[model samples]
Target: MLSIVSIGLVGLPVNAQPLYPTPDPDVFYTPPAELAALKPGDVVRARKIDTGMYVGTEGWQVAFRSTNSMSKPVMGVTTVLLPIGVKNPPLVSYQALINSLGTQCNPSRSLFNGELQDAAGAMLPIGRGWAVSLPDYLGPTSAYGAARLSGMMTLDSVRAVQKVAELGLANSPVALAGYSGGGMATSWAAALQPTYAPDLKLTAAVAGGIPADLEEMALSLGFAPHPGFGLAFAAAMGLEREYPEKLPISDQLNENGLWFREFTHDACRRFLLFHGAFRNAEQMAASKSLMDSPVAREVLRQNSLRHFDGIPSVPVFMWQGRFDELTFFPPVAEVADRYCRAGARLEFRPYEIAEHMTTAVAGFADAWNYVEARFRGEPAPTTC
Candidate 1:
């Protein structure tokens, strides 16, 4: 049940949740002084909050203990939303694709502000009386591209909720859901769950728009000035937060690259899309060949979702747009091939007309249905 968790709630409450974004306070997210003594899912503190979610829900902001890319203790925030009339509902950790370097972009804050990143993905589950967990899988610092850290936070968020006696979800069947950035986090959580947090009841994982390989994307992506290029640069900057010693942005960037950093440091996903609209990513760096170094390769390799020691312990449902601009389809197909060869239970769906952003809503039916079937204890279907 993964019921081994602790919670300390405060009387703090948001007075009429802001309709606009607000700064994420450090007081709730700061790691506890006694972090060394706490476990991964332990809730440091929780606050009751109001959310304008499409599905009627009662919400709470949970700050829980989770590990980072460096395997050090860190605190992350997740919003636990229960359907107003559901009782003892199954749980789904909805890892929204939060692609910004800004703190205000986190889902815990964004949802309350009436911004739904992929609410369509959660509608079906919540409609069928399923509890939803919105985790900031990138951690409180928004380590956007750190694969391992994102997964760890995802798994820990589930564990945090199972222990909340007030939520009444003890031993509930759990599923993981996300798109793009959230997809990367969902895949990693599936890979890491067997060994990391085996006590919980993990069912199926629904992820769309996952970037299978970062190292390949780094070396091969065209350097032409495009909106997509800005995303790549932003990911590199995000990676630096988790791997400062390895990425070394300040040391590697030229004058233009420095401005790119300042432009994106606190920028949200929407702003990041055009930060490099006229600037070339290759020219931004002091040395165009910086990504060719062995150190850089190793770092990217460590963070790529393409390579895993073994197949995930649980079933996975993956969907991607054939013409996805953010995360291409072939690499994802290659990963699917590997899983099929390994005899893992994977259902990979490729959309003919959907792109990166549209695939989440385009394939929401299949994704949520897969999760619902799992919750019903139905036999998992495979497309291997």
Candidate 2:
């Protein structure tokens, strides 16, 4: 029996909230035993409850809390398993890529900065019928710790979902999928899964236009057009959130990295969209020395997925567009090559005609087809 718990219904008042510093953990909730055992076909709707954050075996488990927009008392659902059985259907986790600065602030929109409502303004298709746990892993850190927190949040959410499932809350296998920054999160989660959630049975991961190497991406975007500047700003926020010591700014950027944090939190996404690829990391930093400094390098290193080595515990399906001017092809190819060489069950699909966004949108069908085939017990494609 699937059960839905309605969490708190707080009005969205325009208040200045700190970004980099972590929020109060009390705001979240853990899945109760009764609520966790929700089955694939069962559906229960509750309102004004909270899915508290639980510390997973790997890292901190972030809570994905949201109020149902339509109903009073804000009904929020938890662990609704979609029946696509294969004994234990592989539990697929969807991580939305980074699209805008304030992306996470809006519950109606996707973490990838896509609209939650469709053109008809209906709730966007959230892989509802699919056996998947799509967590808004960005949490409150969307504008701050974009990549690292995203990775941690993604992995922890998978663990959280698994925990709920293991307690007889849901029944399914596990896999992961994401695009752009989400792709980055999925990559990191895959890398960490072997050590983090070894028994979760993650069979595959699909990521598109993944920003694997943050440093290279930052450098690439730092000098480009207007969009680069927005990326740089976003990177700064990420760096400040993940590694506070790396910030060069005295008080605003410094002081435990929380003071002027709010300024960048909501602003970063809009800045990126408005600027749209004009500037890069080099341009964002006030001085060239800061750009070349070791701290900067360290910040870039921490945000990147390249530092994590070894093939994932599960097979990986990665796609990138040759014309993807945003993330580029070479880096994507390099990561794919490395993973393949490491004997990963890797399917590196490149589209000759598609750009970044178009490639991801167009490739979803193929990606899902691959996922469905795997879920139905189809053999994985040979790496060679």
Task: Name the top TM-score candidate.
Answer: 1
Scored by Cα lDDT, where does model 2 land? 0.50
How much is 12 displaced in model 1, in angstroms?
A: 46
Local distance difference test, each candidate: 0.75, 0.50
Q: For model 1, how does the per-residue alpha-carbon lDDT over 1-384 read when each residue is reduced to its tens digit?
A: 000000000111223111112246768867779986799999888887776646498888788999988888988889888889888999999988688777877887667554445656555677789988989888767777788899999999999888878888888899998888889999889878888888766999988888878877765564665557666766776776786655555555667766667767777676777665646666675554544456667777787777765577689999999987668788889888888887878999999854667787787778988999999889899999
**In each prediction, how many residue pairs overlap at the backbone (N, C-alpha, C within less than 3 A)?**
0, 40
Regions of model 1 farther than 4 Å from truth: 1-23, 53-55, 114-116
Q: How well does candidate 1 score on lDDT at residue 187? A: 88
Looking at model 2, report the run of 10 residues with the lowest lDDT sum: 1-10
Q: Give candidate 1's total backbone clashes.
A: 0
Over 110-214, each residue of candidate 2 has an lDDT whose tens digit, in order, gives 322444321111112223234445555554444333455565556655655555433232456566787776687788778766764465567678888877666
